[model samples]
Target: MVFYGVSNFITLFLLFLLPLHSALPPTTTVQINSNSILVALLDSHYTELAELVEKALLLQKLEEAVGNHNITIFAPRNQALERDLDPEFKRFLLEPRNLRSLQTLLMSHILPSRIASHHWPPTHLHHHTLSNHRLHLTTNPTGAKTVDSAEILKPDDVIRPDGVIHGIQRLIIPRSVQEDFNRRRNLRDISAILPEGAPEVDPRTNRLKKPAPVPAGAPPVLPIYDALAPGPSLAPAPAPGPGGPRHHFNGERQVKDFIQTLLHYGGYNEMADILVNLTSLATEMGRLVSEGYVLTVLAPNDEAMAKLTTDQLSEPGAPEQIIYYHIIPEYQTEESMYNAVRRFGKISYDTLRLPHKVVAQESDGSVKFGHGDSSAYLFDPDIYTDGRISVQGIDGVLLPPEEENEDESSTPIRRVKTPLVKVASKPRRGKLLQLACSMVGSFGRVCS
Candidate 1:
């Protein structure tokens, strides 16, 4: 008994420490002259950015003392604070809600050593933030160097012997991360990185893949209209049968009902477009109905839905889209999700409502949907109906898998969140919508 107890304790200790230890990352050591940089940061009255820098510095307990460590610091200037408290900027990078996540992000700004000039990790390349995120960086080596996809308005302000500095046009942040931006981004344009084209990209090459041709006998029109176009009035999805759109909902009528149960129980009224947007499922549904493939639908509850804005909720296509994005056309459950727990393990599936993905958390047995608003989980499984779709309710909203940009091919670093809804459907509520994005963390579930 004593031997067994000791062994179990050791194993438990190792398990507890493993993640924090493994996440320990590379640190940059640059020799510099400005010893006062540390002092300036530690001062309680220093600027917010300076305070953030100080907090970061204190946590690391650096031997460099700002100048001692040869370094480059991308420091924001006085003019940048004109809108510090604004909701957009404040809300940017707000999730992960802790210092470790923040540290990871702040560290992404540092490279292995003091890079004297504008050179690599890749010019126009995006790097992973310490927060385990990817931020867009653009370098105009010819015109002037820039990072974080922002213009360096005043480049290379040396902090004398301590480090180098650059004044950027906007606050630099990780992509799909808007915690800070919401606090200060009243001036930002909504279309900065709205890449043109469909979200599907080839997994192997990281390029956009052509939508597969509709199956040989499939319907002529895309289901974007048929599956999603509202009926004259609301009606329960038809039973699993020859009638209705053969590519049954959520991969089955049961999945649809499962969602209705979630909404009904959570006090919501309808579903989103997760169902109609999955081209592949639409294709498969046309061919096999429910007899093929296991499917799982991660559902969003009313509380999560409540965060969306009236404009987002009232947008003409909003309701349809919410349903489509939330429902997967196939069936997958907690067991499968837990099995596939690493980067390559996640599998994307099509849905009557939206594109869906299932990712696993290896340590915890619980399986949550892959994105924002999807933190919720099923109360129980085995939802059955005349409709064939089987579903389990989750607390948060479901998000589509992150598809890569064709031009960027196979880059390991990618944005955590991708916006799915166009602004036309979302009302401009300033920061509330962006701030609320923490719950969804991107993946277009920031509906309001």
Candidate 2:
């Protein structure tokens, strides 16, 4: 019995020693090179974020830094980047001249230590980012956590020996960059780009004066009123006079004038700024207008534009798409729209930007576009109606068909039906008498 017990003990000791000898080399190697695992995760799951890091030339710095410190990255998702970033700001960061600013912006998302979501405190905590900027963290009563203005969408996405990654919903713009953007947007002089040499103006109409002596073999000058006349008018409007004041109708100048007029007198400065600075659509529109192409634009008021969220406007090419959706290829006036409704009961026009159509119908003597719950009306129609361009003021912004469908699907529908009831009592003498009684009662209540 003693011999057998000793033999079993020897076998157990050898088994333990064998595992120790085999596992020592690999375990130490994995611990030393574990930082690459986080890099791999970024390349695989967070490609967009990875690309931004590479563009800023931050991958080398990250590699060197990861070896020494425990890092935490507030990485934005691809969809979030596509949908929430301001296009102008994104372009600014990608510019070669702004490499330092771009690096600072990227480094601002990294913290020196691992900070998991569960480690977040109830009260606000100020943490310094790698760029030496202060990042504020707050947790609301409802358990929503935010880092600066950006919300943390997914936390603890990757946990490695060297670091962790938390997905955020928006790009965290550094305060300095944001201030710079604001200053540039507000202070930039746009008048410097206006066309030189003012054309002679007609005192009565405030329009450019026509030059005398029409050239032979040139197209006749058609009256602006003729194009505004009612009927099936599908042909392009007559081209503006060459070498006359009409030549001053430079597309860039007209666009500038249109935007400036709205900003100065129409209380649409916010919308105007958005068009000028945010998207290239303003230039495109100006080019088309300069080429003497007739166009109609349904301009949304500032109040209507204020209702749009960052997510709604941040998608790639979203601003241009929205602006294009508002423009109609054909020049349309209020009179023409009314006449069309009278003749055909409705009118359809193609938009300049998308493969979408804007359908108009007369409702209570006013023109409304789109259908059902997606309809928008011209609250201030015929704001500007020259021969070449017509501007109508709309009450709401129009969404594309796909967006409308998504909106409808997400909204809850509550249908309530009114039930009919039969009464045994005799009816009143007449409908006019009942109306008179109700009006008298309403007046009495008002007086009281």
Quote the positional error of residue 143 for candidate 2 in Å: 1.5
Worst 10 residues of 1 by lDDT: 240-249
Writing each residue's lDDT as its tens digit, candidate 1 over 1-448 gives 9999999999999999999898999667754323544443344232665656555543344344343454544555545544643343344434334454345545555432344445534456655433445545565557666665446676554443444555555555442223233212322322332322222334566443454543322322222323232332334432222222222222333333334344323233333333434222333333333322333445554566666678755765565555556656444555445455543444455555423444434334455455554444544443322223445555565545567777876657666996788556666667787777765776465564
* TM-score, per-candidate, Cα-based: 0.32, 0.37
Instruction: Give the best candidate by TM-score.
Output: 2
RMSD, candidate 2, Å: 27.2
Pairs in steric clash, model 2: none
**Model 1, CA-based lDDT:** 0.45
Q: Per-residue lDDT of 1-448 in model 2, one digit per residue for the tens?
A: 9999999999999998998898876632123353563565556578877888888888767766776788889988888677666677688778887788889988999988888888987889999988998888889789998887677889888778788888888778775665454334323332333333323446567455644444322322333322221212224433332223343245565566556446423446556777888866677666555534567888888888898889978887677677777888677888888789778988888885445878888888888887875678878776655455677888778876764555476669897998989879887669898899999999999999
Listed per model in order, the count of residue pairs whose N, CA or C atoms clash below 3 Å is 90, 0
RMSD to the hidden true structure, all candidates: 30.4, 27.2
Once fitted onto the true fold, the runs of candidate 1 whose alpha carbons sit more than 4 angstroms away are: 1-46, 55-60, 63-68, 76-97, 116-122, 125-136, 140-145, 172-350, 353-448
